[model samples]
Target: MLLPRPLLVLDLDETPWHGELGEATQVTFALRPHLGFFLQAVAQAYDLAVWTAAGNDWLQAGLQAIKHETGVDLAAQAVFLWDRGRCTWRRDEAGALHFRKPARKFRARWLRARYPRERILAVDDLAANYACGYGHLVRVTPWTGAPDDTERLDLARYLLQIAPVPDLRALEKRGWRARL
Candidate 1:
């Protein structure tokens, strides 16, 4: 029998859309209608979880809209929308707020037992958040809602290439292309 696919934990905010949460307008977000399509494509081959530092209330409407557009209900795919409350916060060397690590949260769940570190991947714009993930992290460029940003498409192709790898942690950073 074939084993299950790996778990893919994705970050929101600058990774998917552009602009700060408080300053964002509808137009400021990237991938709008296209976001759902991408999610659906990924979900077909991997278990997905959206790990974001944004507030739950602010993300809800956008998620719902994506669901409506693609018929790919995130919840239906067992995708968890983990918000800021689920993150581990710490002060950076520069004394700025840093809320990106998901290690603590994973340690508190059944996931810790179910998925091996090698079979898990976390994609984020900031390397600090998934620092604890070690070889499991994929750092993407921060999306600024630019018309030329092709990170999403490149990411989709990268995931497809690595989806069946027995140990994702063994993959090198150079193996994955973030932007076209």
Candidate 2:
């Protein structure tokens, strides 16, 4: 029997696209280089989902932009599109408010039935965002319109390489870039 595809949770800002506030009512978005290819390639092996700290509006707008530019309908393809409301808020050492994606949420009956902790992975540029779930994180460098950025390209390869592993959480991922 074939195993179910693993779940891949993605972070939006800095990971896939960088948005700059253009005007009082505008936000210009620049997608990371090779994002389209990355998404399409990974989708072949993993079930994609989104979990961003941004508000629902921002998440929706970004997803729309991605679809418009890449022709990949992330919203329609994603198993879940989680926004800030789903995150846990916490204050940092300097007392600055930030949100975290608690990995424990994967234990929810609905989620667990589909994906166990070992069959899940999350990609993010900020390690703090997954502070409570380092084991599930595949850290990528923060992208800010860098034309030469190849993070997504490398990440796509890395994720596919390890997608067949039985226990993804047990594998050390901090040096994922170096692995490629």
Candidate 3:
């Protein structure tokens, strides 16, 4: 019997894309190489969603561009999109907005009411984004849009490796990273 695909929540800015809006002086954007292939591979084995601390306008446009450039049809590949508006925000030490630690954004109470916690994973570059998801984080290195960057492809391999794992919670406590 085919089991339901696990839920995988992906962060957008700095994780998949290069720059974080509020932090970077000149925000440049590009689709990481192998992005389409990686998404397609994950979609075959996991339910995907995009969660970004960026604004809706930027997310929408970037998603559209990604779909157009990669022909991945992100709208179809991802089950949902969670933007800054949906996040619980706070100010950092410098008084700048910090929505990265949006543990509540996972809505554990609401989702757990319907789905199994073991089957939901959040992949992000910043560990802070997983304030309440330590048990579910697949921490990745931040994507810098370098020509040599292979984080997306590497993550696809790790996801595939762990996709068949029966109990994600029983795995290592440290975050999953691509073996260099």
Candidate 4:
């Protein structure tokens, strides 16, 4: 059989979980109701993983809770966990740990080399991620209102529709037309 679809290195920020600010809203904290179906639907074709600023425990519990709520076995297929790993935290010429890009370009580069997949993808909110030029990168707009987040989840589901993606560029291309 064909090699299993390449793993999806999903960023957990605004793409799946609420960003740092929405920590207070328990209802939305778990990406369960939002993207659980997307994950389950795609699991049939591709492996899943979480790479986010959220700590492992939170991400782990959230995954468990998602399966509890939606009855999907995501934990069984997790391929990696880059969340809370060493980030771009270093002093500059001035010796200040400031301006750390949310993601470690260096780390992404390493993963790209290590994972055997000819195709890889990342989903995040910030524009900086696109700078790395990974094959597949998806960004979620700031979730300011109820409809805003709901809409993001809807778009996320769409990506799962055509996974095992032959063309990484296709992920970005498919969602735009639906939004128009």
Candidate 4 TM-score over all chains jointly: 0.63
Candidates in order, TM-scores: namely: 0.81, 0.96, 0.83, 0.63
Q: What lDDT does the true structure give each of the candidates?
A: 0.71, 0.92, 0.73, 0.56
Worst 10 residues of 4 by lDDT: 98-107
Q: What tens-digit string does per-residue lDDT give for candidate 3 at 86-165? A: 77667889998766545555556766553466777888877777776677788877777777888788789888888777
User: Model 3: C-alpha RMSD to truth?
Assistant: 3.6
In candidate 4, what are the lDDT values of residues 55-171, reduced to their tens digit? 676677666766777776656767766555533445669885532234334246556564443455665566554554534556556543344356545655655665655665444
For this target, which candidate reaches the highest lDDT against the unseen true structure? Answer: 2
For model 1, residues 1-180, the per-residue Cα lDDT tens digits are: 565578888887777665443444443344532565567677777898888887786566556655665676665565467888888788879999888666656665677666666778888888878777668788877776777766676787778778888888888865365422
Off by over 4 Å in 2: none
Q: For candidate 1, list the clashing residue pairs, or say none.
A: 100-129
Name the runs in model 3 displaced over 4 angstroms.
1-3, 19-28, 104-114, 173-180
- Tens-digit lDDT track for model 2 on 1-180? 566679999999998999888879698889999989999999999999999999998999899999999999999999999999889997879999988898888899999998988899999989988888899999888888989988787899999999998889999998887887
lDDT of model 3 at position 152: 84
Q: What is the lDDT of residue 109 in candidate 1?
A: 62
Task: Write the number of the candidate with greater lDDT, choosing between 3 and 4.
Answer: 3
Q: Which 10 consecutive positions of candidate 3 have the poorest summed lDDT?
A: 19-28
